[model samples]
Target chain A: MTTPGLTQVLLAGILVVIAIAVARYWRLPVIKDMAFGSVRGFVQLVAVGYAVRFIFDIESPWLIMLALGIMMTVGAHAASGRVKSVKGSFGTCLAAILTGSLITLATMLVFKIISFDARYIIPLAGMIIGNSMNASALVIDRLASDLRANRLAIETALALGKSWREASQKFHRDAARTGMVAMLNFLKTVGIVALPGAMTGMILAGADPVEAVLLQVIVAYMLLSATTITSVVAVELTIRRFFTRHHQLRIDR
Target chain B: MAVTGSILELCNLTRRVGDGTPARAIVDNFSYSFGFGRLYSIIGPSGAGKSSLLRLLNRLDECTDGSVKFKGSDTREFAPCELRQRLGYLFQTPHLFDRTVRDNIVDAQPHLSESKISRLIQQVQLPSGIVDAPVDNLSVGERQRVALARLLATQPEVALLDEPTAALDPANTEAIERLISSVVTDHGVTVVMVSHSRQQVVRLGGEAILMVDGQLIEHGDAVGLVKNPGTPQGRRYMNGEPQ
Candidate 1:
């Protein structure tokens, strides 16, 4: 039985305090969900840590790809639930999440900065997939909210013989616009404002300055690709499902 | 009299929706016709398919077993947007757009003459000042009127309203009832409205369509239905007695 280090234990404690303070300050209704989500995240990371240790040493490239597949699937699932309320566009979440993860993951692997092993593969996959999940969810949630908010305009468009896609175009655009903000910020502030965990870890492991910078650049660029793909795909696919064959909204009449 | 119509028509219509529990197959083997320049009030319980039948005209929900023919053409035959442009439907609780009232109406039919739009706003009896107001700033009555104005802007040959006054005060209710009459008579738009209130049915001055458990029990002559309802459900509805 391997015991966690003192720093690891302290970090967990600090995370709990941070979560509690944030929830209280934001007036979050579900403190329990926040706590459970945080705890579950930490537990998952720990399990992945050991699993990556074994996989990285196994000398099997397929397992590396398998980890990426798993990451994309989970991200897609998260995106689906987040955008389920969006009419017609729920199916779009899968495409967005998977596409986003693939573009980001592919670019990183091709660049050879992180190396094609589970140690880097799993962690990096986790980060890109996690970001894709959030971005796709935001796209779906924002589209649904905007559609409901602009129900009159949409209905009027439908009444005017506009296809469902045409009616919901504004909503899709607005949602995509709002969802991309986070990814855009990450793109703008990648080097000067913050050092992502992966590059920092490599630096601490005695990697050269050029290598760390190269790795960071690849990660930043890939994340941008993934999030952009997600935002676009989710909105387009979801908007398609929102209307009937006659170009009317498939809402309760 | 069984009304003959080219405004809105339901021919051999039967509707089934969902899959048990969440599934509802309330309307079955029913046919009705609505004519131009006539106002129709449909009164029934929650699952009576009053709303479902109205939706058939807009193709929002389909009839499982029969065809809904509008103006002698199958609803499926018309392009949804094209058909809907000439057919307006309003929800019980109006879902107002988050924009100014002018945009809400004019944006739907951008090419419509400005004079017709001003006439529609005036016809709905909405104040001139409310036309530029944001949808969120308006009261429930105001929202419903704006929604109605938007619908009318499409120049619909038929107007389908699902309990348009469900969320309004009595003053607003009377205003909407008056608006319904004004539209049907003036614009020659056929009206099909769902109402749970018998008073609204009486006040709106239309053929009373008494529906119960998704079947039409009584149709035609609102005064006659109230005076001597042929079906038990119709009598119960008129008497305000539990069915």
Candidate 2:
């Protein structure tokens, strides 16, 4: 299979126009978002494609490390934007995303499943960082909202002599599961429901089907580990914001 | 009333909110000493910091200024978990865990035996066999009773009741009132209840404290204080006038 040229890309842009037209015809409020998002997505992806290709050509370890750092920081910022309930959450999100993605990437490298080459490392790390970002955001948002909504239940436990950790143990499990639910669903319904992105991209690039399947399997495991780690760390940090050192609920903060 | 030392004391306890030039005190400079084995009803109109004061006592909400002493030591000295066990709190609306009635009761004291739980059920006047029933099936009043039983299972030195009967019907209210009286009478636990109803305050027949704008306005015998308040704020509160 040959790579698509600018003409093929121009043809794909027509779908965005069709989506915006449909949204306008239905008087949906998201017409502006659709148009703006399509344009922004195009610009961002093109920029990133050029950047990744540049790094891949150079294959400098420092540039690769710098690229990973930029991706994790941007991912953490995006994740923090989604969790508005907690203040000063950017640091927590950054730490969680860093820990999660780094641990998973290190494990993959240590096992020699993937080389240090930017071609393999950058894309895989991007996947891991992106997924970890989402997991961190979901965990923080769910836990914060759950803690707020269940104030009576949590305070009742505290009033009954339970520690803050004890009072919120159930919510911690709930938020962690919520963070991991997406990966779990992917694992459960992979191939049958839909061919996942990495596997499909590999197949589209003319890789053997079995090899793509194997790589997809590794990606799934990588996401599961990253998401679990991110979720646990996010929960640890977020839950502390709702309770004081005295074990009192400080949801106002 | 017992002449023994106070089990719980509030020393200029205050809780303020907001980040303005002068933060508003939800509970301001409130001080009181609660004796062992007595019922004290804190009375006030809405927004008078009745509930806030109760929360401060249990350290569910931290104090902005001053301190709470549980048995003569500042509450900050003890681990909050251990402190709360000795000062069990019941919220205005009971929040029973979604579990069996017995399970809710045993939550405060996990090792509570079947016989002890039955005694608590009897003490709280809940029907027999209701213990095994899921709390979802119980009415709000019964749930309140279950919450009370759970508080009782801790065997607290002082039980903080924040309008525990506020949501109940008159019959349920009377049942809860009776159980509350028994908590002090039968178990010798000090009771500090926040009440909105003047009639209910009189009915409970203990020491009544009137608070206005987060300050202690007056305190006296429950029946007398409700009948003839000593302060202007107390009078306005008793007469249902906006303070």
Candidate 3:
């Protein structure tokens, strides 16, 4: 298969135009968002493509690490926006995504599953950070809402001599599960229901099917580890915001 | 009513819900002392902060402008969990864990023996078979009993009951009142209960503290306070006037 030219890429504009037209004709409220989102996505991806190309050319470990850091920070910011109800959500998202992405990437390097090359590390880190961001956001959002809604049950347990951790244990487990449910579903239906993005992209780019499958397996494992770590960390961090050192629920914020 | 040694004391204990000039003080400048091994009933109209004061005693809600002392020590001195264990609180609406009655009790006191669990069931006047039943399957009254059992399982020195019988029918209310009496007489637990009904307060027959608009309007013997209130606010409350 040959690489598509810029003209071919611009041809995809027809799909966006069709979507915007349908949205307008239906008088949907999100027509503005759809139009703006299409433009923003196009700009952001094009910018990232250039940045990744430059970083790959450098092949410096320091530069690669810096790029990964930038990606995680941006991802954290985006994730934090999803949970507007939580205070200090940016810090929680950053910590969780950092912990999740770095640990998974470090493990892959140590185990020689992937090298420290910019080509492999950059793409892999992007995948881990993306998944981790979603996990952290989901965990924090669910935990905060659950704690707020069930203040009576939680306070009753706390008043019954249970520690803060014990009082919110069920919500923590539930929030963590909420974060991972999407990933779990993805894993369960990976190839049968839909071919995952990485494998499909690799196959479409003329890679051997067997090799693409092997790489997809690695991506799956990487995402699972990242999402799990991010979810647990997010729960731990987010729950602290709702409790005081005295084990009281602080929901006023 | 006796001026015996006190188990808990509230020194101008106050809680404010919001912030602004003239903040809304739920329990304002409230000072009182509860004696050991006695049931004290707090009667007030709705929004009079009876439950707010009870929550402050256990540090369930922080005091905005005062302090609570338990056993001659500031309540803040104790770890909140340890203090709560020592001073258990039963919410008006009993929130039992989504589990069996036995599990709810055990969760409160993990090392509780089977015999003790059975005794708690008996003490709360719950049927023996109810111990094995799921909490969702129990009636509201039964759930309250289970909550009481759970509170007892903690072995608290003081029990703060926020309208423990508010949602119950007369029979269940009487039964819980009997349990409260037994809790004080048999176990020597200090009880602080919040009730809107003046009759229930008199029937419980303890010291009654009448609060109106977050201030203590009057306090004296429960029967005397109901029969003859010292303040106009208390009298109006007894007359069923809107606060």
> Which of the numbered candidates is closest to the native, going by highest DockQ?
2
Which candidate do you rate higher for lDDT, 1 or 2?
Answer: 2
Model 2, position A83, has a per-residue lDDT of 87
Q: Which ten residues in a row have the lowest lDDT in candidate 2 chain A?
A: A1-10
The residue pairs in collision within model 1 are A88-A241, A88-A242, A89-A238, A161-B81, A246-B80
Model 2 misplaced regions, further than 4 Å: A29-32, B1-4
Clash pairs, model 3 backbone: none
Question: Where is model 1 more than 4 Å wrong at Cα?
Answer: A1-67, A74-94, A104-126, A137-162, A170-181, A185-193, A207-214, A238-253, B1-5, B21-23
Residue B210 C-alpha lDDT in model 1: 85
DockQ of 3: 0.84
Ranking by TM-score: 2, 3, 1
TM score of chain A per candidate: 0.78, 0.96, 0.96
By summed lDDT, which 10 consecutive residues of candidate 3 chain B come out lowest?
A: B1-10
Q: After superposition, how far is residue B7 of candidate 1 from its true place, in Å?
A: 3.1
* Predicted structure with the largest lDDT when compared to the true one: 3
Candidate 2, residues B133-225: lDDT per residue as tens digits? Answer: 998999999899899989989989899999988899999999999988988888899999998889999999989999988989999999999
Q: With candidate 3 superimposed using the best TM-score fit, by how many Å does residue B115's alpha carbon deviate from the native?
A: 2.4
